[model samples]
Target: MTYAGVNRLLHWLMAALILGLLTLGYYMTYVADYGLYHLHKSVAVVVALLLLPRLVLRWFKPWQSTVKGKGAKAVHGFHWLLLVLLVIMVVSGAAYSGFGGYGIALFDWPLLAQNIDAQQQVVAHSAALSDWGLAVHIYCAWALCFTLAIHALAALKHHFIDRDGTLIRMLVGEKGARL
Candidate 1:
């Protein structure tokens, strides 16, 4: 089962990082300066990188799902959907950074850009790609936000109302979550 410690560790790490990204994304979009821009890019790049291994792990290792029978499909489907949205978000973010001319970096190392000149290092633009990238990034982010809300609600229902240990399985592991 993918419920091993490494998987849980990765899941929580990504969860915290993604949530931080969401908050940082919102703050940068509406309130702050370019100060956090590099931080945002750094974190995003890490998440993007981390996604691949997590995906591979999940794909190969069968999950011991807490859900059963009828409702399991929806829950499982939603889980996969979250991963799909993550891919979209990561791709679009990279597109925007690279094409939007803002560029990307893992903290300080530049990842994508045509030229790294003094005046036009990462600021060179390809108008179309930039705009499209930004549009998709923003829209998909909001869509992801709503989807996460629903996921959280369902988890809460399972834990608090249903007392079925679904949330426990998610937080811990399937075996550990058993009541």
Candidate 2:
């Protein structure tokens, strides 16, 4: 099966974005640098932007399956679950950052609503939303990290022990068929 070049590019690019944002988030929490916080927020905005197109592409151009076993189906199901969790993480993170009364922009272009605190009620509402969104974001990030480790190991198993093309199918466009 042929996976488009755009799909492979998006996959790797998003992987880098997620990994970078996760690291920045962890570091800035303790470092207490405004610059770091800004950087983290900036990376998150990029993640949010990439996520929209990635989700759309996933639906319109689904990845080809390389495994044929029952367990393979279960793994694919888990992958879909991971995708959902990723969206939750990205959205919650964006909401928390945007409502934290912080300024966020994509190369000087504002993405969120302006004058978010023009009304007293808006401030109160945003504060509440920020709290809950932050909590969910943190929890989901931890869960995602754990799941990512497991997923990586499983891919390695498929590549080495199982001698299958599961990992290859993701990293490359095609799986090598056995002769």
Candidate 3:
């Protein structure tokens, strides 16, 4: 059996989105201009919206498994952990944006309000809250990168070593297909 078409579509779509978000997050943190932060926050919000429904769909619609016993359980557990980490990343990112008093824009629309101070008026800064949010966001993002590496390796192992349909099923949703 293969995954349903819609599930496969969502899976691939989210995979691309998450990868972009991770790359953007890293660049913004280390090598980018200040404006990249705004773009990063907007992308994170998009990921958050897509991920919520995807999680629910994954829980309800089971995929065909190529491995059995402990192997399958381990895969499931890792998937769950990844999802949890991503959710935390999204929440912490939002908190970081809010506590830093910066607004988030969705493409062309305004979602959160920018709180940059006027010359005469000083905005109260909550350094502690911002720091806490930044810590969580950064740590979770790093953890996600590590886990994603394992996930990709696992798929390669299934495709090249196990010679199972696990990777093929995800990629093309074709039953019993091999790499």
Candidate 4:
């Protein structure tokens, strides 16, 4: 079976958003641009908002798998794990930024107040809390990237190797028979 249109749309949209966010996150950290932190945090909040609805929709309107037996089971399990990891990442990111004492902004609107001084110094975070949040956020992001890679590889395998309709089902819904 294929996912519903809403399901397919959410899946693809979230895939893009997550990928973009991951790239931004990496660039912000490794590229040494501390200024990108605000943009990153804002986009992250958008991701969290989108994910909340997607999770609820998935729960209420579960999709039937075209793949039977063990493959279906594994796919279902992986989806759940991915969702959990996403939630963890969102929470950790929020804590890392929020507790850092800099106000979070969406575009130009401020969600949290920027409590910096004339010296542009942010409010102090406890060593333990900030460290834990940063570590969890970073680890979860890497885990998500790895999980997404596996997910894409599986879809490719089903489409090319197994000659299954799984990928097509996701792309265009359950209109035609399994290819």
Candidate 5:
């Protein structure tokens, strides 16, 4: 497959996963059930694992050169920022949760650091870390959502007004010969 095709597939798939996980995390917090919370954490761990491989793939794959308009550059910058923030959010969240003496896992695989607390006070302290991580996670998620909205709108604009193949290159894997 072409670079654009791979990128498009990864983009949409990751978007769906992240959005679903975020929604579930938000809802799970309100419910006072340990099982539901475990489910949420499991989904988050999966997302983190998936994201790591996706990031590695992106690094190894060459990006198709797009039009170098100012708007396009800005959009690309926003995308890079979003990627970094997402990684931070995932790692911090996993660390925080694990440190709180809650070993969240998928099936039987533990995907985070093991908490070695010997006393309730240590667990309580770790819980505070979880709270801080949760706050940062929510903030990053909102920023990502806003960036996604802008990214979608920009693609629509290119498709309708610019009459360029910007959107098509990513969607259909047909890069325009000239930018």
Candidate 6:
């Protein structure tokens, strides 16, 4: 069965946004400090917002896989784990930004930590939250990269090797596709 257009749209959009975030995130952290934190945080909030609706849609219309047998369990498990990791990333990133004395921003708009010592230097609570949140965020970032690679390779296998409609279902879902 094919996913509806909206579902597929959300899937691809999230995929692009996430991939972009991962690249931008890595560059900002390791490559150079070009002052892209605001952009990263802004886009992250957008991704977080999109995640909610995508999850709700998935709940109502779950995607079915063509793969069966023993590997199916692993595939499903990985997908679920990816979702959980996304939740963790969002929470940890927010904690690091919001509670670390830096207000969470969406293109200069305040989301959180707008007034709570945002002007002052890092406080004790901010430091603690920053420590824990940064640790989790960094770890999860690598985990996310590995999982995403696997997910992409799986999709490629389905499309190229399996030649199943799995990739098609996601790529160009039919109108009013219900299942």
Best lDDT goes to which candidate?
Answer: 1
Off by over 4 Å in 1: 1-3, 114-125
List ranges where model 4 is wrong by over 4 Å: 1-3, 176-179
After superposing all C-alphas onto the true structure, candidate 2 shows an RMSD in angstroms of 3.7
Write the residue-wise lDDT of candidate 5 on 43-139 in tens digits. 6767777777667876786344455778556666776776887787786676567656566678567754355566533353467787777677777
The lowest-lDDT stretch of 10 consecutive residues in candidate 3 is 118-127
How much does candidate 4 score in TM-score?
0.89
Tell me the tens digit of each residue's lDDT in model 6 across 70-121: 9778877887788888888999998887767677888888877543546665
Tens digits of per-residue lDDT for model 4, 1-179: 23477788888988988999999989988988988887888888888888998899878876676678997888788988999999999888767767767667886888877668789888745546767788999999999999999989988998899877888878877675343
Cα RMSD (angstroms) for every candidate in the order listed: 2.3, 3.7, 2.7, 2.5, 4.0, 3.4
Candidate 2, residues 63-174, lDDT tens digits: the string is 6566678966887787787788888987787778677655466645776643355463334337788888889998998998888788789879888998877666567655
Clashing residue pairs, backbone N/CA/C < 3 A, model 5: none
Write the candidate numbers in order of decreasing TM-score.
Answer: 4, 3, 1, 6, 2, 5
Give the number of colliding residue pairs in candidate 4.
1
Worst 10 residues of 5 by lDDT: 116-125
lDDT of 3 by residue, 1-179 (tens): 23477777877888898899889878877886677776777777788888987788778975546778887888788888988998999888877777767656787677877676667442425667767888999999999999999999998999899987778877776754743
Model 6, 114: alpha-carbon shift in Å?
4.6
Model 6 pairs whose backbones collide: none
In model 6, which runs have C-alpha deviations exceeding 4 angstroms?
1-3, 114-124, 174-179
Candidates in order have lDDT scores of: 0.83, 0.73, 0.79, 0.82, 0.69, 0.81
In order of appearance, the predictions have TM-scores of 0.88, 0.81, 0.88, 0.89, 0.74, 0.87
Q: Clashing pairs in model 2?
A: none
Report lDDT (Cα) of residue 66, candidate 5: 56
Cα error, candidate 2, residue 147 (Å): 1.3
Model 2 accuracy (lDDT, Cα): 0.73
> Who is ahead in lDDT, 4 or 5?
4
